[model samples]
Target chain A: MTSKQQDKDIHQYDIHQKKGFSSEEINAMSQSVLNEKLDNIDAVTLSRLHQARQQAVDAAVLRPSFLQRYWPDRCNLSRSDHPILQPLVLVGLIIFALGTGYLMSHTRTDQLNLGQGEYLANEDDLEVAEDLDFIAWLIEQDKVSDNHAG
Target chain B: MQAQQQRNHLDHFLARVERRAFHLAQLATGQTQPALDIVQDAMLTLSKKYAHKSPSEWGPLFHRILQNKIKDWYRHQSLSQRIIDWFGKKSSVRDEPDDVIQTAVDRQTPLPFERLKNEDLRQALNMAIEKLPRRQQQAFLLRHWEGFSVKQTARVMQCSEGSVKTHVSRATQFLKQQLEGFYHDQ
Candidate 1:
């Protein structure tokens, strides 16, 4: 605080004196005003604080996971030295494992489905197979003609 | 279930303390962003290191972390100020973006003394507290505002109980002097 500001504050005190406002009264007034002030803290700051609190709790609350206890550093994959790396890398790996498990499970289910569908002769496949036979005959005839020409 | 319970416990603890922690940081640092950052760092440290401890142990642990953060801020500021002084004199040193408690008096809440009903006393109290020395401010606020006992304040401040008493006594005198214009000298 500047001396000018301090002087201004002192000067303001000169404007009015709640004379003989005892030490106890000063404490009371201080408590009252401060509580009022803290209560009136801006909505934005309170919201920011709410966000910071959640983030702190999430990033720091001790779960004592196997990896966290065994590996003191929690084994980060990220090159950055950000403190949140330990939990984040753990979470990311867990999510990746879950995704891989889901895909592998779905793939087996899909293969079973394909096996069920295999005996059902699709009419389009039948038509393609007939076309393949005709194309093979045409190719053999063309080969014979080419041999003659040679 | 235990994990969820712990989380809820930690969350409630942090919520109960965040506002008071912010207020302490603001008074100590006199800058909004740094105060917020200090509170955040303190919270994170407490959560990371001591969350697994019993709930009863969290209060002193949190207070210690907060005081250390504020001290770190002071040290960092002192170093930066020294470097700036070595370089050159630029009066615009305190040109921070987020105006903290410093702006509360004039700019943020601008009410003329004439129109001041109950606000004048509040405004005067804010100014008096802001004018206090750093340690006294910390001692006074922690003791009276946070309702920590002198022994607890001493523990949080890492000082003797006698020193805590002296600091609080001096702070009370300074505050009373500043507000009531009595007991002029500290």
Candidate 2:
């Protein structure tokens, strides 16, 4: 048959089938036959099917939840079996420790600098007070000497 | 508690559809082992990825997964076959005769229809369905056998509704042509 003719024939068949002119009945019958065929599958095949299904169920049961499957170690920190998270946690801890050490050292240096500044200021004030006292004592002695000479 | 409920729901859904999914895979691949593997793989994928989806969505989701798995298997087979051919090896795929397709369905027990007493017609119907293009076969099975609506079939097949209707129409036409004698005899 020509391609056009074949197309036309197929279109007609489509219409006829859609109109349910015995085609529907045939479809139902064929479906039932297919169902029976599946029902009566060989024992070996059925056994294999059962095994496959059991395996699937077992796998499904063992399957992790969304959080467990995707985030796994990230979600449940208690589970040590997470291969990816262990290294990640170790690295994170190392970074955190390094950051804290740097910040602590910086803070301590700032405090030490402030303490040194305050100590230097106190020492300078004490030295100035002692110098003032000595100068005052010399003036008093000089005044005593002048009174005696007079 | 919710996790456990979801697992139970997913298990129940897989159990419900396992047989039909197997049959569809079997028909699509025309082999037993590949079909079994496809079904199992589809089940694993559905449970792994989509177990959290609502129960109503599972049907189409599972079928879509199954269909994609079948397509992947076909692509793998063809690619391997091409490599084998390039090496000048006697390709096992080419050695299989076209008529060998009958053996898959012929192994089935007979049906009760008086009109279907002729086993050739039954085999012809099966062969004809198997021989359809992947889209048409998917459209036919999803719409007619699985009773999916055109919209649902489109969703499962990842096609527009118009495409689903066209595929189903063509599938119905071809199936009618192949099984015309049985219908006419009635």
Best candidate per TM-score, number?
Answer: 1
Q: In candidate 2, which residue pairs clash?
A: none
lDDT of 2 by residue, A67-131 (tens): 44555343555332555676776688799999999999999989877953665478777787789
RMSD of each: 16.1, 13.4
**Whose DockQ is greatest here?**
1
Model 2 residue runs over 4 Å out of place are A1-23, A61-150, B1-5, B92-118
Chain B TM-score (each prediction, in order):
0.84, 0.84
lDDT of 2 by residue, B25-111 (tens): 877877777888898898888766666556888899899999999999999989998898899986764344433333344345654
* Model 2 per-residue lDDT at B155: 76
What is the C-alpha lDDT profile of model 1 across A1-150, one tens digit per residue?
999999989866864454545566677767776676666567667877898899888976665556545552434332234657667767888999999999999999898889636644788777777898899999999999999999
The lowest-lDDT stretch of 10 consecutive residues in candidate 2 chain A is A71-80
